[model samples]
Target chain A: MDVTNRIERALTEALSQADLAGCPPRLAAAMRSAVFPRGARVRPRLCHSVAAACGDDNPATEAAGAALELMHCASLVHDDLPCFDGADIRRGRPSVHKAFGEPLAVLTGDALIVLAFQTIARVNCAPDRLLKLTQVIGSAVGVPLGIVAGQAWECESEINLAHYHRSKTGALFVAATAAGAASAGADPEPWRMVGEKIGEAYQVADDLRDAAADEDEIGKPVGQDVAHDRPSAVREMGIDGAVYHLKSLVRGAVEAMPPCSNGNELRSLIMSEATRLVPAKLAQSAA
Target chain B: MDVTNRIERALTEALSQADLAGCPPRLAAAMRSAVFPRGARVRPRLCHSVAAACGDDNPATEAAGAALELMHCASLVHDDLPCFDGADIRRGRPSVHKAFGEPLAVLTGDALIVLAFQTIARVNCAPDRLLKLTQVIGSAVGVPLGIVAGQAWECESEINLAHYHRSKTGALFVAATAAGAASAGADPEPWRMVGEKIGEAYQVADDLRDAAADEDEIGKPVGQDVAHDRPSAVREMGIDGAVYHLKSLVRGAVEAMPPCSNGNELRSLIMSEATRLVPAKLAQSAA
Candidate 1:
């Protein structure tokens, strides 16, 4: 299967595993439905690219991929807590906390955190490499320097968009590539730049969609950033500038890869994704 | 150094590497104080036993030991959340949520989860073995079978005490032994029974105390199980029956260990601990 297809399957499977408890049906269904066909399995796709780059053909690769997705979902679940974002809606539907009571949502988020590590740890890989992957995954998901820190930014009055995106989005990207490399027994350090470059650009792309992309075009509604007064690429750098930043990042990612056979295709996919995310003028329909 | 002291120092140093931002001084102090100068470090001591049993003497054993304690602390943090136990106090002080608001408590719990894997991942063991350790820790902490499931028993209408303790308490014990063995390059399966037996017995002893132990002596307060209407050995098996069960399980733990230098001491410890848990003097104190 293609990387996207495999990632989708893996993510659905991971969510299923995380949801095996005898949860309230409405909550269980909502959590599953929230996950089944997620808008973007970006983290997993990046994971696949890095794994393929580092010659990873093992179950650890899939595990790392699915694990990152689970972590992202967990962050979202917690971020919607009453104290964090107090968000009642997500993906044009009720957020997990809104659909399920806050208590179940709390448990679900807790479960997701456990599930992420479980997924990574269960991957059958060389023990050392698996350790590296787990370490990388853990570092990307936690405080001051990770998604946890990213969420903390919301509670603070002065937010740095750069710092915010790096922790919230870039950290996972860095981890996906690093984890992929670790899975294949790569040094992991070499892939770091590739992850950072792409990760930053992805954040910029996310910023772009905050205003440029319509709600249907992106899974979540546009303009929440503006509503929240959170800084963004579109706000700081403008839409065209964000696109330029993305192109520059794609270049960096392409350049960061080694002379491995899979490198070129990986570069192409990232570039294509960047292009796909770029704004396009729609053709006028026939009158 | 004594086993407990050595393990606590190792854990303190290992936890220092956690560099999450927004760590309030009080939270840091609380985290430090909550663990530091710990009472027994029984879990770490358990890690040491299995590691020694498998002939591991590296500093990585320290990491494995620390990881177990960290995971335990993280579970406590989550368990004390308003949605879970609603516990405002723990270890004779305000719990994490009480000290640092719910958002930070949640983030702190998340940080500990990541930190546990990071600890094991950075250990001196071979990468593959370390990976297994990370996985073991995550599995111990994960849901449906981990501590999260154990906590979920509270939400459940009729949790079998055995099942609850097995998942909540036994799971960690099992992970500790498994991690210790993994650090020593052991297959870890051989030691699974040891953890199960010890974990189950510990819970019975705990329940036995809950039935009659004094609030001052237990240090947390008894009658919590009854207050919460939570299932327990005292509730089902009664105090006398719980003691009998504990003795049998202690026998099983002694029998389960390999014929090694530590076996006699471990057996003695379990026996003494069982005795200490239910002695006439303690009963008098409880009354």
Candidate 2:
């Protein structure tokens, strides 16, 4: 199966395991909806591509990719809660909290996080490698310098925009690359740069979209950066400046690709994804 | 250090790691408050005791125990959210959501869960044992049959009380025992029963306190089962009957200890914990 299909199947199976005979119907249903009718599946695909570049297509790689996607999906669910962005729509559908109520939404996010780790645990791999994969992913998901710290930045009255953006948006992207490498028994440290650049570009794109796109175009609330007083490239720099920065980060991602047998293929993948990350709409808005 | 002190030191270190210079102050504070002044710390203690019984008093076992406590603490924070039980106080203080605001509370819970796995991954053990430790704890925290499922039971209109209680409360206890055993290179399966019985007894004790004790006595709101219409042993079988069940479960925990060189010591530990689990207050209330 293709990477997206594999991720979808893995996610579906994970949710099914939670939806056993006496499982709460709404919680089970929300878990499925939170992951399915998916988003871009960017992180998982990036992970898979990196693993392929490293010359291993093992279950560890697939599992790592799927787990990364699950964590991404989980972040979205929690981010949309009333206490956070309070977004009522996600990927053009009712948000988990909106559809199933806030309690179920909270539970769904928690369950998905657990499922991510559980999925990684089940993968067939060298135990040391598996432990490394878990650490890389776990650090990206948690605090200090992870996505959780990124979101927590909003709670602060003052913040450094660069650090905030990296932790919130760049951490998982970094995790995806590092975990993919670790899963394939390659040096994970070099891949961190690849993830950081992609993640920075992705965050800039998100900022641009939030600043310029309509609710219909974005599939969720727009102008959230302004509404939430969040730190964003579009807010700190103008739309034009943000676009320029995003393109630079994209180039950085391509340049950061470590030497490997599949280096050229990975570069092309990164370039194609860069265009998607900073789409024409962003350019049009900046123009 | 004793288990409680060791667990506290480990947790303090974990939170400090997340409290980097630029980390959001409120998020950092909330994470600390969510775990400090912890309730009984039963899960971590159980885990440490089991690991000791299995003849491994290594850092890996300490890490596993701390991780379990972090997971348990995370659940408590989320469980007390406005959308769930909505309790204003936990462990005799303002709950995380109430003290730090809802957004911080949510983020605090998320960061702690991630911290749990990170702790285990950092353990100084053989790769396979660390992997097993992660799996054992992850399964207890996630869906199909973890604490997440336990909370999800409330969303369902109907639930088998036995399954609800087990998943909601017993799963973590089971993980504590199983993880402790795994950390020692011992077979983990045999230790599961010890956890289950202790967990079941703990739940019944909880139900008894919620049903019969005053708010001051329990350090939180009382009568929550009736208020939320949750499945409870005390509610299902009257307080007296529930007390009887608690005693029986305590006895089962004693009998369930697997044979080891430290069998006599472990049995004594279980009996002491059993008394604590079913305190004299429960007997007085039943009378």
Give the per-residue lDDT of model 1 (tens digit) for B1-287.
Answer: 76776797888776675444543333345455445546556778788877776776467778888888887887778778787677887767777788777887777777777777777767665676676776677767765567766665555546655556777889898887887788877788878898889888888878777777676665666687888777788789776677677878888987887645345545666567667666354444332
How far in Å is the alpha carbon of B202 misplaced in model 1? 2.3
Worst 10 residues of 1 chain B by lDDT: B18-27
Estimate, for each residue in B63-140, the C-alpha lDDT of model 2 and write its tens digit. 888899899999999999999888899988999998888988888988999999998888777888888998899989
Clashing pairs in 1: A126-B128, A127-B127, A127-B128, A127-B129, A128-B127, A128-B128, A131-B131, A144-B21
After the best TM-score superposition of candidate 1, give how far the Cα of residue B107 lies from its true spot, in angstroms: 1.0
What DockQ do the predictions score, one after another? 0.37, 0.73
Per-candidate interface C-alpha RMSD?
A: 3.6, 1.5
- What fraction of correct interface contacts does each candidate retain? 0.48, 0.77
Fill in the DockQ of model 1.
Answer: 0.37
- Model 2: lDDT equals 0.84
**Position B13, candidate 1: lDDT:** 77
lDDT score at residue A183, model 2, on the 0-100 scale: 86
